[model samples]
Target: MLTTLSRIVKSGWLNFWRNRWLSSSAISIMGLTIFVTTSLLLINVLTNSLVQILRDKIDISVYFNLETTEEQILETRKSLIDLEEVESVEYVSQEEALEKFEEKHQDNQLLMQSIQELDDNPLEASLNIKAGTASQYEQIVDFLNGSQYKEIIDKINYRQNQAVIARLSSITAVLQRSGVVVSIILALMAVLITFNTIRLAIYSSREEINVMKLVGAGHWHIRGPFIVEGAFYGLVAAVIVLIIFYPVLWLLSPKMTAFLPGSDLFYFFRINFWQILLLQIAVGVSLGVASSLVAIRRYLRD
Candidate 1:
């Protein structure tokens, strides 16, 4: 079995190098396919990360009446945390809220003057609620409104922030869906190109193939070399892409971080290195082997 396998591999290598131009063309196309596939996967990961970041950053602030005390707010915060959908609830006292507002507006002379003229801290004591998902915010608001302490809750800022949340969720959802569709279309085109390239390469060797068949060579023996060649194309392409991909990732990490404040593309890439390599191999080998098999089957049918 080992000897047969070795012969098959040797024959595949010879077949690959014999038609240098055709094999090179196939390898190049397969390389591009792997490249595109890997890039799309990264974009998909980043899209998910961006969506999650936006969700994590956006939360609803529940402002209370002036009469509401810090203890009451803290009590409400405790209840909010007990809810399954609530990821966290932060209580901000009126004094602290006012300080934050003043600090934020310190650069504006008019706003600072207006704030300074106030007899007391005008900001309301509040609880900021962060839910597990975009869809759960409404449920949290409903809970706050109907709770035993509802009378103390002056307002939940859901109305003011709902549009922004919905818009961000919608955009991210659209981006994720569109990315999948585009990736599929591009991958199909790549596969089609591969299939056709191998088919044409096989067509040129039809006479040799027919002569071999006349010698009563079994189907496996006849088809083994082409299959091996196809796998080789995928294998080599994957290696070439990895060599190019890692360095490119290292170079782009800093720039990506600057463009996106919370993103660490390099870290993600590094952590997922083995997964990425395996994915490349799976895609490359599948594309190559499938294309070769289909092409050979067609030629055999004649």
Candidate 2:
């Protein structure tokens, strides 16, 4: 078995080397396909991370009337925290809100003058409520409005920002749907390209294959070399893709971070290095093997 395996490997390598242009052509196609698929996967992951970050930044601040006591607000906070969808609820006192406003506007002389003209701090104490998802924000708002503490609540600021949240929700939905459709199409294209490339390679060796069969060569003996050849193409393509992708990501990481503040593309790439490597290898090997199996099946039956 070992001797037969060695011969098959040698024959596959010899065939690949002998037909340099054909092998290179197949490898190039595989490389391009893998590159596109890898890039899409990376983009999808990064987009998801960014969306979560944005969602985290978004929350509904419920301001209470000046007459509302700290104890009443704390009770309201406790109620909000009890909700299943609520991730967190924070109570901001009137004094804390005033301090925050002063800190924010200290650099602006005009804003500072306007604040000084007021007799007292006009800001209200509030509870900032965050939900696990955008969809849950509405439920949080509903809970706040219907609760016994609703009379003390002056305003829910989420209504003011509803338009922005709606737009983001629509955009995320479209992106998710589009990603699935595009991925499916790309996968189909990759499979077809691989199948055709393997078929062409096999056609070139049709006479040799026929001679082997005439000599009563076993199916495994006839199929093993082709499988190995396909795998070789896949492995080479995967390597080429990684070689190109790593540097390309390195070059673009800074630019990507500029557009997406706090996002470190290079860091994310590094973190997912092994997964990406495995994906490339899987794509290459699967394409190569499946294509070869498909092309050889008809001949084997004959």
Candidate 3:
């Protein structure tokens, strides 16, 4: 068995080296396909991360009437927190709000003068409500509006920002659907390309294959070399892709960070290296092996 395996490996390597250009052509195609798939996967991951960041930033600020007591606000917070979708609720007193505004506009002398001229903190105490998902924000807002303390609840700022949130949600939905459709189409195209490449390679060796069949060689003996050849192509393409992608990402990381401040593109890619590697290898190997197997099956059955 070992001897037969060694012979198959040797033959596959010899054939690959002898027809270097053809083999390289197939590998190049596989490499490009893998690169596109990997890029899409990376984009999807980044989009999800960005969407989560946006969702986290989407909060409903429930302003309390100036006369509303701290105890009443605390009770309202507790009630909001009891909702299963509620991730967190924070209370910001009027004084704290004023301080925050002042800190934010410290450079604006005109704004500073206006704030200083106020007899007292005109801002109302508010609760910042966060939900687990963007879709849940409306439900929380509805609950707040229907609550007994609704009178003391000066306003729910959710309505003010509804249009922006709705647009973001729509965009995210379209992105997810488009990602799935594109991935499927790309995967099918890759499979077809690989299959055709394997068929061409097998056609070139048709005479030799027929001669072996006539000599009464076992099925495994006939199939082994082709399988190994396919695997070799897959491995070679995967290695090429990894080599190219690593440096490309490294070069682009800084630019990505610059475009999206606080983005962890470099760190995210580094952390997901193993997953990406495995995915690339899987796609490469599956394409190569499945294509070879299908291409050879018809000849073998004959």
Model 1: residue 138 alpha-carbon error in angstroms: 2.8
TM-score of 2: 0.91
Candidate 3, poorest ten consecutive residues by summed lDDT: 257-266
Cα lDDT tens digits, model 2, 1-302, are: 99999998898888888888999999998887788888788777777777877787788899999899999999998888899999998889999998999999899999889988999778899988888877788888988888899899899999898987777766766777788788889877877877897898888888888899999999988888888889889899999999998899899999988887777778888998988888899989888888888898878888
Candidate 1 regions off by >4 Å? 69-71, 106-121
Candidate 1 residue-wise lDDT, 1-302, digit = tens = 88888888899889988878888888888999999989888887778777777888789999999998778888888888999999988888888898899888889999899888989888888888888877788898888888888899888889999998788767767877898899899888887887888787778878877887898776777788988899888988888999899999899978977876777777888998999888898888888888888888866764
lDDT digits (tens) for residues 1-302 of candidate 3: 89999998898888878889989988988887788888878777777776676777778899999999999999999998999999999999988999999999999999999979989888899999888877788899888888898899888898998988787777767777888888888877877787898889888888888999999988888888888788788888988898888888888879977865567666777898888888888888888888888888878987
Model 3 alpha-carbon miss at residue 75, Å: 2.6
Clashes of each: 0, 0, 0
* Candidate 2 steric clashes: 0
Displacement of residue 159 (Cα, Å) in model 1 is 1.6
TM-score of each: 0.87, 0.91, 0.90
| Candidate 3 residue runs with Cα over 4 Å from true position | 105-120
